[model samples]
Target: MALVAVLILTLLSLGIALSGTLTRLLLVVVPYAVFTLFLAGVVYRILKWARAPVPFRIPTTCGQEKSLAWIKTSPLESPPCLWGVIGRMALEVLLFRSLFRNTRLDMGQNRPVYPSAKWLWFFGLTFHWSLLIIVLRHLRFFIEPIGPCITALSSLDGFFEIGVPTLYLSDAAMLAGITFLFLRRLIVPQVRYISLFTDYFSLLLILGVVTTGLIMRHFFPADLLQVKNLALGWVTFSPFVPQGVGTLFTMHLCFVFTLLVFFPMSKLMHAGGVFLSPTRNLANDSRIRRHVNPWNAPVKVHTYEEYEDEFRAQMKTAGIPVEKE
Candidate 1:
Protein backbone atom coordinates (compact mmCIF):
# COMPACT_ATOMS: atom_id res chain seq x y z
CA MET A 1 0.00 0.00 0.00
CA ALA A 2 2.81 2.38 0.86
CA LEU A 3 4.60 1.56 -2.38
CA VAL A 4 1.39 2.09 -4.34
CA ALA A 5 0.82 5.45 -2.63
CA VAL A 6 4.34 6.61 -3.48
CA LEU A 7 3.95 5.48 -7.09
CA ILE A 8 0.62 7.30 -7.34
CA LEU A 9 2.20 10.48 -5.97
CA THR A 10 5.07 10.16 -8.45
CA LEU A 11 2.68 9.59 -11.33
CA LEU A 12 0.52 12.56 -10.28
CA SER A 13 3.60 14.81 -10.12
CA LEU A 14 4.77 13.62 -13.52
CA GLY A 15 1.27 13.97 -14.95
CA ILE A 16 0.91 17.53 -13.61
CA ALA A 17 4.32 18.58 -14.92
CA LEU A 18 3.62 17.03 -18.32
CA SER A 19 0.35 18.94 -18.50
CA GLY A 20 2.24 22.13 -17.45
CA THR A 21 -0.83 23.39 -15.56
CA LEU A 22 0.34 23.63 -11.92
CA THR A 23 4.04 24.23 -12.51
CA ARG A 24 3.99 27.53 -10.63
CA LEU A 25 1.95 26.02 -7.80
CA LEU A 26 4.33 23.08 -7.54
CA LEU A 27 7.42 25.27 -7.87
CA VAL A 28 6.43 28.10 -5.55
CA VAL A 29 3.33 27.67 -3.38
CA VAL A 30 3.90 24.06 -2.28
CA PRO A 31 7.38 24.76 -0.98
CA TYR A 32 6.31 27.86 0.94
CA ALA A 33 3.18 26.20 2.35
CA VAL A 34 5.04 23.09 3.49
CA PHE A 35 7.82 25.17 5.05
CA THR A 36 5.26 27.21 6.98
CA LEU A 37 3.51 24.08 8.29
CA PHE A 38 6.81 22.44 9.23
CA LEU A 39 8.07 25.49 11.13
CA ALA A 40 4.79 26.29 12.87
CA GLY A 41 4.15 22.66 13.86
CA VAL A 42 7.64 22.21 15.30
CA VAL A 43 7.37 25.43 17.33
CA TYR A 44 3.92 24.48 18.63
CA ARG A 45 5.07 21.03 19.70
CA ILE A 46 8.13 22.46 21.44
CA LEU A 47 6.05 25.05 23.29
CA LYS A 48 3.53 22.42 24.37
CA TRP A 49 6.32 20.28 25.78
CA ALA A 50 7.84 23.29 27.57
CA ARG A 51 4.52 23.93 29.30
CA ALA A 52 4.28 20.34 30.63
CA PRO A 53 5.09 20.21 34.34
CA VAL A 54 7.85 17.73 35.25
CA PRO A 55 7.31 18.52 38.99
CA PHE A 56 10.38 16.49 40.00
CA ARG A 57 13.68 15.00 38.87
CA ILE A 58 13.02 11.84 36.86
CA PRO A 59 16.15 11.27 34.82
CA THR A 60 16.53 7.66 33.74
CA THR A 61 19.75 6.14 35.09
CA CYS A 62 21.67 2.96 34.26
CA GLY A 63 24.85 2.99 36.34
CA GLN A 64 25.84 3.94 39.91
CA GLU A 65 24.47 7.25 41.20
CA LYS A 66 26.64 9.78 43.04
CA SER A 67 26.49 9.25 46.83
CA LEU A 68 29.31 8.89 49.38
CA ALA A 69 32.60 10.68 48.73
CA TRP A 70 34.47 7.36 48.60
CA ILE A 71 32.08 5.77 46.04
CA LYS A 72 32.83 6.00 42.32
CA THR A 73 30.01 7.06 39.98
CA SER A 74 29.39 6.53 36.26
CA PRO A 75 28.65 9.97 34.91
CA LEU A 76 27.69 8.92 31.42
CA GLU A 77 25.19 6.33 32.60
CA SER A 78 23.97 8.16 35.73
CA PRO A 79 24.77 11.85 35.57
CA PRO A 80 25.00 13.69 38.92
CA CYS A 81 25.81 17.21 37.71
CA LEU A 82 25.20 19.55 34.75
CA TRP A 83 28.57 18.82 33.10
CA GLY A 84 27.95 15.08 33.35
CA VAL A 85 24.47 15.47 31.85
CA ILE A 86 25.93 17.54 28.99
CA GLY A 87 28.55 14.87 28.36
CA ARG A 88 25.92 12.13 28.38
CA MET A 89 23.65 14.09 26.04
CA ALA A 90 26.59 14.69 23.70
CA LEU A 91 27.35 10.98 23.53
CA GLU A 92 23.66 10.16 23.12
CA VAL A 93 23.06 12.66 20.31
CA LEU A 94 26.33 12.15 18.46
CA LEU A 95 27.18 8.48 19.01
CA PHE A 96 23.78 7.01 20.06
CA ARG A 97 25.43 5.62 23.16
CA SER A 98 22.22 4.03 24.53
CA LEU A 99 21.45 2.39 21.20
CA PHE A 100 24.95 0.94 21.25
CA ARG A 101 23.76 -1.22 24.12
CA ASN A 102 20.74 -2.56 22.25
CA THR A 103 19.89 -6.10 23.28
CA ARG A 104 17.82 -8.97 21.91
CA LEU A 105 16.04 -11.02 24.50
CA ASP A 106 15.09 -14.69 24.25
CA MET A 107 13.75 -17.42 26.54
CA GLY A 108 16.34 -20.08 27.24
CA GLN A 109 15.27 -23.01 29.48
CA ASN A 110 12.45 -21.02 31.10
CA ARG A 111 14.74 -18.09 31.88
CA PRO A 112 15.15 -14.91 29.83
CA VAL A 113 18.46 -14.33 28.07
CA TYR A 114 19.66 -11.13 26.48
CA PRO A 115 22.14 -11.00 23.59
CA SER A 116 23.81 -8.07 21.89
CA ALA A 117 21.96 -6.66 18.84
CA LYS A 118 24.07 -3.88 17.41
CA TRP A 119 22.94 -3.98 13.76
CA LEU A 120 19.96 -1.67 14.44
CA TRP A 121 22.28 0.83 16.09
CA PHE A 122 24.82 0.60 13.25
CA PHE A 123 22.30 1.07 10.43
CA GLY A 124 20.47 3.78 12.37
CA LEU A 125 23.73 5.68 12.77
CA THR A 126 24.59 5.18 9.10
CA PHE A 127 21.19 6.49 7.89
CA HIS A 128 21.39 9.60 10.09
CA TRP A 129 24.99 10.48 9.12
CA SER A 130 24.33 9.89 5.42
CA LEU A 131 21.16 12.01 5.54
CA LEU A 132 23.09 14.79 7.26
CA ILE A 133 25.83 14.69 4.62
CA ILE A 134 23.30 14.71 1.79
CA VAL A 135 21.52 17.75 3.29
CA LEU A 136 24.87 19.53 3.72
CA ARG A 137 25.83 18.74 0.12
CA HIS A 138 22.55 20.18 -1.16
CA LEU A 139 23.17 23.44 0.78
CA ARG A 140 25.23 24.49 -2.29
CA PHE A 141 22.00 25.10 -4.21
CA PHE A 142 20.50 27.55 -1.68
CA ILE A 143 23.65 29.54 -0.77
CA GLU A 144 25.34 31.77 -3.38
CA PRO A 145 29.02 31.19 -4.17
CA ILE A 146 28.68 27.84 -2.28
CA GLY A 147 30.70 27.63 0.94
CA PRO A 148 34.11 25.89 0.92
CA CYS A 149 33.03 23.39 3.61
CA ILE A 150 30.16 22.03 1.50
CA THR A 151 32.42 21.94 -1.56
CA ALA A 152 35.09 20.01 0.35
CA LEU A 153 32.51 17.64 1.80
CA SER A 154 30.95 17.05 -1.64
CA SER A 155 34.37 16.36 -3.09
CA LEU A 156 35.15 13.94 -0.27
CA ASP A 157 31.78 12.19 -0.75
CA GLY A 158 32.59 11.59 -4.44
CA PHE A 159 36.27 10.73 -3.86
CA PHE A 160 35.73 7.28 -5.42
CA GLU A 161 34.90 8.93 -8.79
CA ILE A 162 32.78 5.99 -9.95
CA GLY A 163 30.73 7.63 -12.73
CA VAL A 164 30.47 10.69 -14.98
CA PRO A 165 28.86 12.70 -12.18
CA THR A 166 30.79 10.83 -9.47
CA LEU A 167 28.54 8.71 -7.25
CA TYR A 168 28.26 9.97 -3.63
CA LEU A 169 29.02 7.36 -0.93
CA SER A 170 26.36 8.96 1.21
CA ASP A 171 23.69 8.27 -1.41
CA ALA A 172 24.46 4.54 -1.54
CA ALA A 173 24.87 4.31 2.25
CA MET A 174 21.57 6.08 2.87
CA LEU A 175 19.80 3.71 0.51
CA ALA A 176 21.32 0.68 2.18
CA GLY A 177 20.52 1.94 5.66
CA ILE A 178 16.91 2.65 4.75
CA THR A 179 16.63 -0.73 3.08
CA PHE A 180 17.91 -2.55 6.16
CA LEU A 181 15.65 -0.64 8.51
CA PHE A 182 12.58 -1.14 6.36
CA LEU A 183 13.33 -4.85 5.87
CA ARG A 184 13.91 -5.39 9.59
CA ARG A 185 10.42 -4.14 10.33
CA LEU A 186 8.86 -6.40 7.71
CA ILE A 187 10.97 -9.52 8.29
CA VAL A 188 11.27 -9.53 12.07
CA PRO A 189 8.14 -11.05 13.59
CA GLN A 190 8.31 -9.00 16.76
CA VAL A 191 8.74 -5.73 14.87
CA ARG A 192 6.28 -6.62 12.12
CA TYR A 193 3.52 -7.32 14.64
CA ILE A 194 3.95 -3.84 16.14
CA SER A 195 4.56 -1.93 12.90
CA LEU A 196 1.93 0.54 11.70
CA PHE A 197 1.14 2.16 8.37
CA THR A 198 2.98 5.33 9.35
CA ASP A 199 6.26 3.46 9.86
CA TYR A 200 6.04 1.88 6.43
CA PHE A 201 4.79 5.11 4.90
CA SER A 202 7.72 7.16 6.16
CA LEU A 203 10.28 4.70 4.80
CA LEU A 204 8.57 4.28 1.42
CA LEU A 205 8.13 8.03 1.13
CA ILE A 206 11.86 8.62 1.69
CA LEU A 207 12.70 5.79 -0.66
CA GLY A 208 10.68 7.51 -3.36
CA VAL A 209 12.50 10.81 -2.78
CA VAL A 210 15.94 9.18 -2.96
CA THR A 211 15.09 7.05 -6.02
CA THR A 212 13.71 10.04 -7.96
CA GLY A 213 16.68 12.18 -6.96
CA LEU A 214 19.18 9.51 -8.05
CA ILE A 215 17.37 9.06 -11.37
CA MET A 216 17.49 12.81 -12.01
CA ARG A 217 21.18 12.98 -11.08
CA HIS A 218 22.32 10.05 -13.18
CA PHE A 219 19.73 9.26 -15.85
CA PHE A 220 18.05 12.54 -16.86
CA PRO A 221 20.36 15.07 -15.20
CA ALA A 222 18.54 18.17 -13.88
CA ASP A 223 19.70 21.59 -15.11
CA LEU A 224 22.06 22.66 -12.29
CA LEU A 225 22.02 26.39 -13.16
CA GLN A 226 18.22 26.50 -13.28
CA VAL A 227 17.93 24.40 -10.14
CA LYS A 228 20.36 26.54 -8.18
CA ASN A 229 18.60 29.73 -9.28
CA LEU A 230 15.22 28.37 -8.19
CA ALA A 231 16.58 27.25 -4.79
CA LEU A 232 18.35 30.56 -4.13
CA GLY A 233 15.42 32.66 -5.32
CA TRP A 234 13.05 30.80 -3.00
CA VAL A 235 15.43 31.28 -0.07
CA THR A 236 15.87 35.00 -0.83
CA PHE A 237 12.09 35.66 -1.08
CA SER A 238 12.33 36.31 -4.83
CA PRO A 239 10.71 33.29 -6.50
CA PHE A 240 12.15 32.01 -9.78
CA VAL A 241 10.51 29.39 -11.97
CA PRO A 242 12.82 28.12 -14.63
CA GLN A 243 11.88 25.87 -17.56
CA GLY A 244 13.53 22.42 -18.18
CA VAL A 245 14.07 21.68 -14.46
CA GLY A 246 12.47 18.30 -15.39
CA THR A 247 9.36 16.56 -14.00
CA LEU A 248 11.64 14.22 -12.03
CA PHE A 249 12.88 17.19 -9.94
CA THR A 250 9.26 18.14 -9.40
CA MET A 251 8.46 14.66 -8.08
CA HIS A 252 11.49 14.74 -5.79
CA LEU A 253 10.51 18.15 -4.51
CA CYS A 254 6.96 16.93 -3.84
CA PHE A 255 8.22 14.00 -1.82
CA VAL A 256 10.52 16.30 0.19
CA PHE A 257 7.70 18.75 0.85
CA THR A 258 5.44 15.94 1.97
CA LEU A 259 8.11 14.69 4.33
CA LEU A 260 8.64 18.18 5.74
CA VAL A 261 4.92 18.62 6.30
CA PHE A 262 4.68 15.23 7.98
CA PHE A 263 7.81 15.71 10.11
CA PRO A 264 6.51 17.65 13.12
CA MET A 265 3.35 15.60 13.54
CA SER A 266 5.08 12.26 13.08
CA LYS A 267 7.78 10.47 15.08
CA LEU A 268 10.34 12.44 13.05
CA MET A 269 9.76 15.27 15.53
CA HIS A 270 12.26 13.36 17.69
CA ALA A 271 14.88 15.31 15.72
CA GLY A 272 13.93 18.40 17.74
CA GLY A 273 12.12 16.76 20.67
CA VAL A 274 15.26 14.93 21.85
CA PHE A 275 16.72 18.15 23.20
CA LEU A 276 13.69 18.70 25.43
CA SER A 277 13.41 15.14 26.79
CA PRO A 278 13.66 15.42 30.58
CA THR A 279 14.89 11.83 30.96
CA ARG A 280 17.79 12.67 28.67
CA ASN A 281 18.48 16.35 29.45
CA LEU A 282 18.01 16.34 33.23
CA ALA A 283 20.73 15.40 35.73
CA ASN A 284 20.21 12.54 38.22
CA ASP A 285 20.75 14.59 41.37
CA SER A 286 17.85 13.57 43.62
CA ARG A 287 20.31 12.36 46.25
CA ILE A 288 22.26 15.61 46.57
CA ARG A 289 19.50 18.17 45.98
CA ARG A 290 15.80 18.66 46.69
CA HIS A 291 13.23 19.42 44.00
CA VAL A 292 10.25 21.11 45.64
CA ASN A 293 7.18 21.44 43.44
CA PRO A 294 6.41 25.16 43.35
CA TRP A 295 2.84 24.39 42.25
CA ASN A 296 2.01 22.54 45.51
CA ALA A 297 -0.64 24.22 47.67
CA PRO A 298 0.33 25.35 51.23
CA VAL A 299 -1.77 24.18 54.20
CA LYS A 300 -1.91 24.88 58.00
CA VAL A 301 -1.64 21.95 60.42
CA HIS A 302 -3.31 21.68 63.91
CA THR A 303 -1.36 19.67 66.54
CA TYR A 304 -2.96 16.85 68.61
CA GLU A 305 -2.53 19.06 71.79
CA GLU A 306 -4.50 21.90 70.16
CA TYR A 307 -7.22 19.46 69.13
CA GLU A 308 -7.34 18.11 72.74
CA ASP A 309 -7.48 21.67 74.19
CA GLU A 310 -10.42 22.58 71.96
CA PHE A 311 -12.28 19.37 72.84
CA ARG A 312 -11.44 19.49 76.62
CA ALA A 313 -14.38 21.81 77.51
CA GLN A 314 -16.81 19.67 75.54
CA MET A 315 -15.37 16.49 77.12
CA LYS A 316 -15.83 17.94 80.68
CA THR A 317 -19.41 18.92 79.86
CA ALA A 318 -20.07 15.35 78.72
CA GLY A 319 -18.48 13.88 81.97
CA ILE A 320 -15.51 12.42 80.05
CA PRO A 321 -11.88 12.52 81.35
CA VAL A 322 -10.05 15.63 80.02
CA GLU A 323 -6.24 15.55 79.98
CA LYS A 324 -6.04 19.39 79.74
CA GLU A 325 -8.38 19.95 82.75
Candidate 2:
Protein backbone atom coordinates (compact mmCIF):
# COMPACT_ATOMS: atom_id res chain seq x y z
CA MET A 1 0.00 0.00 0.00
CA ALA A 2 2.82 2.43 0.95
CA LEU A 3 4.82 1.53 -2.16
CA VAL A 4 1.75 2.01 -4.35
CA ALA A 5 1.08 5.40 -2.75
CA VAL A 6 4.66 6.57 -3.33
CA LEU A 7 4.57 5.37 -6.94
CA ILE A 8 1.26 7.17 -7.50
CA LEU A 9 2.66 10.34 -5.98
CA THR A 10 5.74 10.19 -8.22
CA LEU A 11 3.62 9.55 -11.32
CA LEU A 12 1.21 12.36 -10.35
CA SER A 13 4.13 14.73 -9.91
CA LEU A 14 5.43 13.78 -13.34
CA GLY A 15 1.98 14.25 -14.88
CA ILE A 16 1.70 17.73 -13.37
CA ALA A 17 5.15 18.70 -14.64
CA LEU A 18 4.44 17.21 -18.08
CA SER A 19 1.16 19.11 -18.31
CA GLY A 20 3.25 22.29 -17.93
CA THR A 21 0.95 23.41 -15.13
CA LEU A 22 3.84 23.86 -12.66
CA THR A 23 6.99 23.88 -14.74
CA ARG A 24 8.77 26.71 -12.91
CA LEU A 25 7.44 25.50 -9.57
CA LEU A 26 8.68 21.92 -10.09
CA LEU A 27 11.97 22.91 -11.73
CA VAL A 28 13.02 25.76 -9.47
CA VAL A 29 11.00 26.10 -6.25
CA VAL A 30 10.59 22.39 -5.48
CA PRO A 31 14.25 21.54 -6.04
CA TYR A 32 15.44 24.52 -3.99
CA ALA A 33 13.02 23.80 -1.16
CA VAL A 34 13.85 20.08 -1.15
CA PHE A 35 17.59 20.78 -1.10
CA THR A 36 17.22 23.27 1.76
CA LEU A 37 15.06 20.79 3.70
CA PHE A 38 17.55 17.98 3.10
CA LEU A 39 20.41 20.09 4.50
CA ALA A 40 18.45 21.35 7.52
CA GLY A 41 17.01 17.92 8.32
CA VAL A 42 20.44 16.25 8.13
CA VAL A 43 22.00 18.95 10.34
CA TYR A 44 19.19 18.69 12.89
CA ARG A 45 19.49 14.88 13.12
CA ILE A 46 23.31 14.97 13.46
CA LEU A 47 23.13 17.67 16.16
CA LYS A 48 20.48 15.73 18.10
CA TRP A 49 22.70 12.63 18.08
CA ALA A 50 25.77 14.72 18.94
CA ARG A 51 24.08 16.19 22.04
CA ALA A 52 23.31 12.66 23.34
CA PRO A 53 25.80 11.76 26.07
CA VAL A 54 27.35 8.28 26.20
CA PRO A 55 28.11 7.87 29.91
CA PHE A 56 29.85 4.47 29.64
CA ARG A 57 32.40 2.64 27.50
CA ILE A 58 29.94 0.51 25.49
CA PRO A 59 31.82 -0.31 22.30
CA THR A 60 30.60 -3.64 20.91
CA THR A 61 33.47 -6.11 21.15
CA CYS A 62 33.90 -9.18 18.93
CA GLY A 63 37.46 -10.24 19.75
CA GLN A 64 40.01 -10.68 22.59
CA GLU A 65 40.64 -7.70 24.88
CA LYS A 66 44.01 -5.95 25.23
CA SER A 67 45.35 -7.61 28.42
CA LEU A 68 48.32 -10.02 28.47
CA ALA A 69 51.29 -9.15 26.24
CA TRP A 70 51.47 -12.67 24.82
CA ILE A 71 47.77 -12.87 23.86
CA LYS A 72 46.92 -11.41 20.44
CA THR A 73 43.96 -9.00 20.16
CA SER A 74 41.95 -8.16 17.04
CA PRO A 75 42.33 -4.37 16.88
CA LEU A 76 39.65 -3.85 14.24
CA GLU A 77 37.17 -6.21 15.89
CA SER A 78 37.54 -4.81 19.38
CA PRO A 79 39.17 -1.42 18.98
CA PRO A 80 41.32 -0.56 22.02
CA CYS A 81 42.62 2.80 20.75
CA LEU A 82 41.63 5.73 18.51
CA TRP A 83 43.54 4.41 15.49
CA GLY A 84 41.88 1.02 15.82
CA VAL A 85 38.47 2.67 16.04
CA ILE A 86 39.22 4.72 12.90
CA GLY A 87 40.33 1.64 10.98
CA ARG A 88 37.21 -0.26 12.03
CA MET A 89 34.99 2.66 11.04
CA ALA A 90 36.76 2.89 7.67
CA LEU A 91 36.10 -0.79 6.94
CA GLU A 92 32.47 -0.42 8.05
CA VAL A 93 31.82 2.64 5.90
CA LEU A 94 33.79 1.57 2.82
CA LEU A 95 33.37 -2.20 2.67
CA PHE A 96 30.56 -2.88 5.18
CA ARG A 97 32.77 -5.43 6.93
CA SER A 98 30.21 -6.24 9.60
CA LEU A 99 27.44 -6.90 7.10
CA PHE A 100 29.87 -8.99 5.07
CA ARG A 101 30.12 -11.28 8.10
CA ASN A 102 26.33 -11.46 8.57
CA THR A 103 24.89 -14.86 9.38
CA ARG A 104 21.51 -16.43 8.68
CA LEU A 105 19.93 -19.21 10.69
CA ASP A 106 18.44 -22.36 9.13
CA MET A 107 16.45 -24.98 11.02
CA GLY A 108 16.37 -28.61 9.94
CA GLN A 109 15.15 -31.62 12.00
CA ASN A 110 14.91 -29.60 15.21
CA ARG A 111 18.46 -28.31 14.81
CA PRO A 112 19.62 -24.86 13.72
CA VAL A 113 22.57 -24.00 11.54
CA TYR A 114 24.17 -20.58 10.98
CA PRO A 115 25.37 -19.73 7.48
CA SER A 116 27.10 -16.60 6.14
CA ALA A 117 24.70 -14.26 4.27
CA LYS A 118 27.30 -13.07 1.76
CA TRP A 119 24.75 -12.63 -1.06
CA LEU A 120 22.88 -9.94 0.92
CA TRP A 121 26.15 -8.17 1.62
CA PHE A 122 27.20 -8.37 -2.02
CA PHE A 123 23.91 -6.93 -3.28
CA GLY A 124 23.91 -4.20 -0.63
CA LEU A 125 27.51 -3.25 -1.43
CA THR A 126 26.83 -3.24 -5.17
CA PHE A 127 23.68 -1.11 -4.78
CA HIS A 128 25.47 1.51 -2.65
CA TRP A 129 28.67 1.66 -4.72
CA SER A 130 26.80 1.77 -8.01
CA LEU A 131 24.48 4.50 -6.75
CA LEU A 132 27.52 6.48 -5.61
CA ILE A 133 29.18 6.10 -9.01
CA ILE A 134 25.98 7.20 -10.79
CA VAL A 135 25.76 10.24 -8.50
CA LEU A 136 29.43 11.12 -9.14
CA ARG A 137 28.85 10.65 -12.88
CA HIS A 138 26.21 13.39 -12.58
CA LEU A 139 28.86 15.86 -11.33
CA ARG A 140 29.63 16.57 -15.00
CA PHE A 141 26.26 18.36 -15.21
CA PHE A 142 26.84 20.60 -12.17
CA ILE A 143 30.53 21.47 -12.63
CA GLU A 144 32.29 23.26 -15.46
CA PRO A 145 35.38 21.71 -17.11
CA ILE A 146 34.66 18.34 -15.40
CA GLY A 147 37.69 16.90 -13.60
CA PRO A 148 39.82 14.10 -14.97
CA CYS A 149 38.68 11.75 -12.19
CA ILE A 150 35.01 12.09 -13.17
CA THR A 151 35.91 11.68 -16.84
CA ALA A 152 37.97 8.59 -16.08
CA LEU A 153 35.16 7.11 -13.99
CA SER A 154 32.56 7.81 -16.68
CA SER A 155 34.77 6.20 -19.33
CA LEU A 156 35.31 3.12 -17.20
CA ASP A 157 31.59 2.80 -16.36
CA GLY A 158 30.62 2.98 -20.06
CA PHE A 159 33.42 0.77 -21.37
CA PHE A 160 31.01 -1.88 -22.73
CA GLU A 161 30.13 0.19 -25.86
CA ILE A 162 27.02 -1.93 -26.40
CA GLY A 163 24.73 0.72 -27.86
CA VAL A 164 25.04 4.00 -29.79
CA PRO A 165 24.84 5.89 -26.48
CA THR A 166 27.19 3.58 -24.54
CA LEU A 167 25.46 1.85 -21.65
CA TYR A 168 27.00 2.23 -18.18
CA LEU A 169 27.50 -0.90 -16.07
CA SER A 170 26.59 0.90 -12.86
CA ASP A 171 23.02 1.37 -14.10
CA ALA A 172 22.53 -2.37 -14.63
CA ALA A 173 24.28 -3.27 -11.39
CA MET A 174 22.21 -0.76 -9.38
CA LEU A 175 18.96 -2.05 -10.88
CA ALA A 176 19.89 -5.69 -10.33
CA GLY A 177 21.00 -5.03 -6.75
CA ILE A 178 17.85 -3.09 -5.91
CA THR A 179 15.59 -5.73 -7.47
CA PHE A 180 17.34 -8.52 -5.58
CA LEU A 181 17.06 -6.63 -2.31
CA PHE A 182 13.34 -5.98 -2.85
CA LEU A 183 12.70 -9.62 -3.84
CA ARG A 184 14.70 -10.85 -0.87
CA ARG A 185 12.38 -8.98 1.47
CA LEU A 186 9.34 -10.58 -0.18
CA ILE A 187 10.71 -14.09 -0.66
CA VAL A 188 12.21 -14.57 2.79
CA PRO A 189 9.39 -15.24 5.30
CA GLN A 190 11.35 -13.95 8.31
CA VAL A 191 12.50 -10.83 6.51
CA ARG A 192 9.05 -10.26 5.05
CA TYR A 193 7.48 -10.57 8.50
CA ILE A 194 9.84 -7.92 9.88
CA SER A 195 9.59 -5.60 6.85
CA LEU A 196 7.76 -2.30 7.19
CA PHE A 197 5.90 -0.29 4.58
CA THR A 198 8.70 2.26 4.43
CA ASP A 199 11.17 -0.47 3.46
CA TYR A 200 9.18 -1.40 0.36
CA PHE A 201 8.41 2.25 -0.37
CA SER A 202 12.06 3.22 -0.37
CA LEU A 203 13.06 0.39 -2.68
CA LEU A 204 10.19 1.08 -5.09
CA LEU A 205 10.92 4.82 -5.13
CA ILE A 206 14.59 4.26 -5.96
CA LEU A 207 13.66 1.68 -8.58
CA GLY A 208 11.22 4.15 -10.14
CA VAL A 209 13.91 6.81 -10.27
CA VAL A 210 16.44 4.44 -11.84
CA THR A 211 13.90 3.15 -14.38
CA THR A 212 12.90 6.66 -15.43
CA GLY A 213 16.55 7.67 -15.74
CA LEU A 214 17.31 4.67 -17.91
CA ILE A 215 14.30 5.52 -20.10
CA MET A 216 15.57 9.06 -20.56
CA ARG A 217 19.06 7.79 -21.29
CA HIS A 218 18.14 5.24 -23.93
CA PHE A 219 14.49 5.27 -25.00
CA PHE A 220 13.13 8.79 -24.71
CA PRO A 221 16.23 10.98 -24.96
CA ALA A 222 16.70 14.45 -23.49
CA ASP A 223 19.17 17.16 -24.51
CA LEU A 224 22.30 16.65 -22.37
CA LEU A 225 23.56 20.22 -22.98
CA GLN A 226 20.25 21.76 -21.89
CA VAL A 227 20.10 19.48 -18.85
CA LYS A 228 23.64 20.54 -17.93
CA ASN A 229 22.65 24.18 -18.42
CA LEU A 230 19.68 23.72 -16.08
CA ALA A 231 21.91 22.01 -13.48
CA LEU A 232 24.51 24.83 -13.77
CA GLY A 233 21.77 27.42 -13.40
CA TRP A 234 20.52 25.77 -10.22
CA VAL A 235 24.07 25.69 -8.76
CA THR A 236 24.67 29.34 -9.74
CA PHE A 237 21.46 30.39 -7.91
CA SER A 238 20.07 31.83 -11.15
CA PRO A 239 17.74 28.91 -11.75
CA PHE A 240 16.54 28.34 -15.30
CA VAL A 241 14.37 25.54 -16.68
CA PRO A 242 16.18 24.80 -19.87
CA GLN A 243 14.33 24.47 -23.22
CA GLY A 244 14.16 20.99 -24.81
CA VAL A 245 14.32 19.26 -21.39
CA GLY A 246 11.26 17.01 -21.81
CA THR A 247 8.70 15.79 -19.28
CA LEU A 248 10.77 12.63 -18.72
CA PHE A 249 13.64 14.74 -17.35
CA THR A 250 11.18 16.67 -15.21
CA MET A 251 9.88 13.35 -13.84
CA HIS A 252 13.43 12.24 -13.12
CA LEU A 253 14.12 15.51 -11.27
CA CYS A 254 10.90 15.07 -9.29
CA PHE A 255 11.96 11.62 -8.09
CA VAL A 256 15.36 13.02 -7.11
CA PHE A 257 13.74 15.94 -5.27
CA THR A 258 11.42 13.59 -3.42
CA LEU A 259 14.39 11.44 -2.44
CA LEU A 260 16.30 14.45 -1.10
CA VAL A 261 13.32 15.62 0.94
CA PHE A 262 12.70 12.13 2.34
CA PHE A 263 16.31 11.06 2.94
CA PRO A 264 16.98 12.61 6.37
CA MET A 265 13.56 11.71 7.74
CA SER A 266 13.80 8.08 6.65
CA LYS A 267 16.01 5.08 7.52
CA LEU A 268 18.28 6.36 4.71
CA MET A 269 19.85 8.63 7.34
CA HIS A 270 21.69 5.48 8.53
CA ALA A 271 24.32 6.71 6.08
CA GLY A 272 25.15 9.44 8.60
CA GLY A 273 24.08 7.62 11.76
CA VAL A 274 26.73 4.92 11.22
CA PHE A 275 29.41 7.49 12.03
CA LEU A 276 27.68 8.42 15.28
CA SER A 277 26.97 4.85 16.46
CA PRO A 278 28.64 4.38 19.88
CA THR A 279 29.24 0.68 19.28
CA ARG A 280 31.12 1.25 16.04
CA ASN A 281 32.88 4.59 16.63
CA LEU A 282 33.99 4.33 20.27
CA ALA A 283 37.22 2.60 21.38
CA ASN A 284 37.04 -0.48 23.61
CA ASP A 285 39.28 0.96 26.31
CA SER A 286 37.27 0.33 29.50
CA ARG A 287 40.10 -1.75 30.92
CA ILE A 288 42.75 0.84 30.03
CA ARG A 289 40.95 4.04 31.14
CA ARG A 290 38.21 4.96 33.61
CA HIS A 291 35.09 6.49 32.04
CA VAL A 292 33.54 9.09 34.34
CA ASN A 293 29.96 10.06 33.61
CA PRO A 294 29.90 13.76 32.78
CA TRP A 295 26.32 14.12 34.03
CA ASN A 296 26.89 12.34 37.38
CA ALA A 297 25.45 14.16 40.40
CA PRO A 298 27.25 14.90 43.63
CA VAL A 299 26.22 12.62 46.51
CA LYS A 300 27.20 12.81 50.19
CA VAL A 301 29.04 9.65 51.23
CA HIS A 302 29.25 8.29 54.83
CA THR A 303 32.82 7.42 55.78
CA TYR A 304 33.83 4.27 57.81
CA GLU A 305 35.74 6.61 60.23
CA GLU A 306 32.56 8.56 60.96
CA TYR A 307 30.66 5.34 61.64
CA GLU A 308 33.41 4.03 63.92
CA ASP A 309 33.50 7.36 65.89
CA GLU A 310 29.69 7.29 66.32
CA PHE A 311 29.79 3.70 67.65
CA ARG A 312 32.79 4.19 69.99
CA ALA A 313 30.69 5.08 73.10
CA GLN A 314 28.33 2.06 72.59
CA MET A 315 31.36 -0.24 72.23
CA LYS A 316 32.95 1.06 75.46
CA THR A 317 29.64 0.57 77.39
CA ALA A 318 29.55 -3.08 76.27
CA GLY A 319 33.20 -3.55 77.45
CA ILE A 320 34.14 -4.02 73.78
CA PRO A 321 37.52 -2.86 72.34
CA VAL A 322 37.14 0.58 70.78
CA GLU A 323 39.53 2.39 68.42
CA LYS A 324 39.51 5.57 70.61
CA GLU A 325 40.42 3.60 73.82
Among these predictions, the greatest lDDT belongs to 1
- Worst-scoring 10-residue span by lDDT in model 2: 12-21
TM-score of 2: 0.93
lDDT of 2 by residue, 13-57 (tens): 768666754877787777789889999999999999988988888
CA displacement after TM-score superposition, residue 199 of candidate 1 (Å): 0.6
Tell me how far the alpha carbon of residue 67 in candidate 2 is from the true structure, in angstroms, after superposition: 1.4
Which residue pairs collide in model 2, if any?
A: none
Instruction: Estimate the TM-score of every prediction.
Output: 0.91, 0.93
lDDT string, candidate 1, 46-151, tens digits: 9999888888888899999999989998988899999999999989888888999999998989999999999999999999999999999999999989999999
